[model samples]
Target: MYQASKQRYETMPYRHVGQSGLRLPAISLGLWHNFGDVDRLSNQKEILCGAFDRGVTHFDLANNYGPPAGSAERNFGRILREELGQYRDELVISSKAGYYMWPGPYGEWGSKKNIIASCDQSLQRMGLDYVDIFYHHRPDPDTPIEETAGALDLLVRQGKALYIGVSNYSAEQTVAIAKVFKKLGTPFIIHQPRYNMFDRWIEDGLTDVLTQENLGAITFSPLAQGLLTNRYLNGIPADSRAGRSSSPFLSPENVEATINKVQQLNQIAQNRGQSLAEMALAWNLRQPTVTSVLVGASRLSQLEDSLKALNHLDFAAEELAQIDAIVGK
Candidate 1:
């Protein structure tokens, strides 16, 4: 059985996930980069337990998170069965689909068949009767939005998912989907998107719509896939994600520009008594609609350090200004 920390909630600040009665920890753990079949199961379990002991009540996942695809959820399924079954009500486990999974038409995209079947597969992978929230990983232009929304509604009614969400949606798309969920009487609880000090795509418009519609926003890659951290300052470490993986997002050209921005942001974080990663996490939460900043760590220490974002959330006006200049918008 899992013995959670007595002061878990005392250190973390739980924010309302938009207008919903549910509140999530300001910093949530994401299993996007780690918890794969290739990684040591013991290490993965340690990180999971370490996160919970430190008050990370929300765990974010996707069908394609693992290198082997779905392995992350499968591993987490074992953890849930062996360690977290007793604490189910104390945690919010969310999973998303919409990325390619299997062969044929039903394996990917936002079709009703895909959404429903993905949820079913996700439940089996996680070994749970219902996930706290189920999301369409991204918008599919070919599929009707109404059909996608209908699939989410059907999941809720079928007791497979408690709430629904959409990820990587534009401001216009978010509003449009919200309307569909509204008509279907489904609670669209949250929106997941990539956001960080170096990237502010949602600030221009998407966040505004979330505010008006009362949908919670959980910012993914708040550390910009570790670009915003101190890891890339001197040079990319041999163990860093950029050095190990082949990602279109973290190229050498991007690293050069990001280095300059991170240097500036690092100074701002120092002035605020926080590390660069902590400040990066806090920066996303400054937005009123942002309920949580989803972070992924390769180690337990990194997860612990990231949780310090809740230590001090206040931001000086000049600090905000400096961040804006660094981000170039």
Candidate 2:
């Protein structure tokens, strides 16, 4: 008996994916961290519903998102079935396959067998007939690009996915596979890259390729895995991701290396009347080729804070230059 806000679409902005007919909200919800078996279902429902109420129509997931693997999809599927089933057509649910999922050789990589089988398994876990956009999680050095692109095209033909994308691909890799997808007549629409003020690798060449190829780009980790947020300004909290011993990505040394830069950036964000997180998210969207930014929040308040970045998406040239100087861009 949950009701979505009638004013959901009033505040959120939607942009077309490249030159395609599909569009996505400026901020898409990413279920990478909190929507897992270890988390409570009620909390998950609350966050999901809160995001939808604010016009987050796209929910990004992957086959290996959960620590236990596939748990996030199972949890999200239950939430969809028990709470938001009525809003299925109104939402764009995306899932990717490219990381480790199972025990044997067929479990990982971008081979034809792995890609197709992973999509099927993801669909089953999510209790869905078709996902809006399915992505190849990463490039497989051992597999032929042709096989991977062919598998995605096959998924579209089988009616399992509407559009296709690739994540963590370089400019060269994207151009190579894009040609194959173009020849196959696959509706390859988007590329998911890790981009933020701290990570500028995509700007080196990927953005140009995406723009040239007319492919939309959605950036993951737009907050630089929480480094761009205010959480670490005073030092890492005992409960924060950086404080956790098991977190492979954010380490104490890494935080120490970038803490001063983060503090400097915070001052700039304060001058602009925005939080560090808001400015970070806005920075990624400044690129016209970037269709959307994928963000994950453990609570409704965090999500609300992220949505505020839309208020000041416009940045002066001086501000951009200052940011680049502070981050050593």
Candidate 3:
């Protein structure tokens, strides 16, 4: 009963994942927060459909995305079965593992057992045979880099995943794993890091490593988990992410620390004829290695607003310098 847009690809841009042949939409949808069972199924469907209608073909997920665990994938799987299954090849779906899932020792981390099992569980939940990209959510301090890399390599060999990626890894850790992946001939092509105007840690050394290894980066929390948006320009609304007691990453003190800079950034965005959110997302895409900007949109309007970032991805030298000065470069 659902129809896709005839002009879906009219405006959206797709960027290559490093040197790989694959390309992802510049603005990919992330089901990190609101696609779970706690949210309305109707809202979720609307957002997903709206994204695809705008040419967003990639959807990022993880095993532990739901508060109840695995609910986001289930809900998305239902949406796919009923609405988008016919377009499976046109979509690039990714899921990650590394957080706690079950209770036993094999329940989490980057071990061969946990990684493979988590991928299987994700595939089952989504009613799919293989995901486009599978990621190890984070580095395990205890696991050897070779072992973790081996587990991911095995996923591709077993036909459970097409490409391998890692999230929240350091430059050194990435290089270590890349070595093993290269030897095993794994198609490890992407890295997901928490990057934003406020959080520029990826710029330190990770960007260089990614460039050298030819591994693309898709950034998470590009808006500093909602701080770079207009939601907190005046004050944190009761419904805003920072106002929620559950996600303490953006506490009142954190918002206070960056409010001045955020306001300045908003002014620059207004000058560029974009909202703060659009400018913030464009800032992340400005990085050469960032193949896509992965963000969560609970509503269709938010997704529409985000898609506007593509309109003005270019920045003047003075604008860049002003942003750097405001964020204390």
Which candidate leads the pack in lDDT?
A: 2
Taking all chains together, each candidate's TM-score versus the true structure is: 0.97, 0.98, 0.98
Q: What digit string (tens of lDDT, one per residue) describes model 3 on residues 27-129?
A: 9999988999999999999999888999999999999997579999999999999888888999999999999999999999988889989999999999999
Error of 2 at 285 (Å): 0.9
Model 3: weakest 10-residue lDDT segment is 239-248
Off by over 4 Å in 2: none
User: Which stretches of candidate 3 lie above 4 Å from their native place?
Assistant: none
TM-score of 2: 0.98
lDDT tens string, model 1, 201-228?
8988998998899999998888877788
Q: What would the per-residue lDDT of candidate 2 be over residues 153-241, giving only the tens digit for each residue?
A: 99999999999999999999999999999999999999999998888899899989998999999999998888999989989899988
Q: How much is 312 displaced in model 1, in angstroms?
A: 1.8
The better-scoring model by lDDT among 1 and 2 is 2
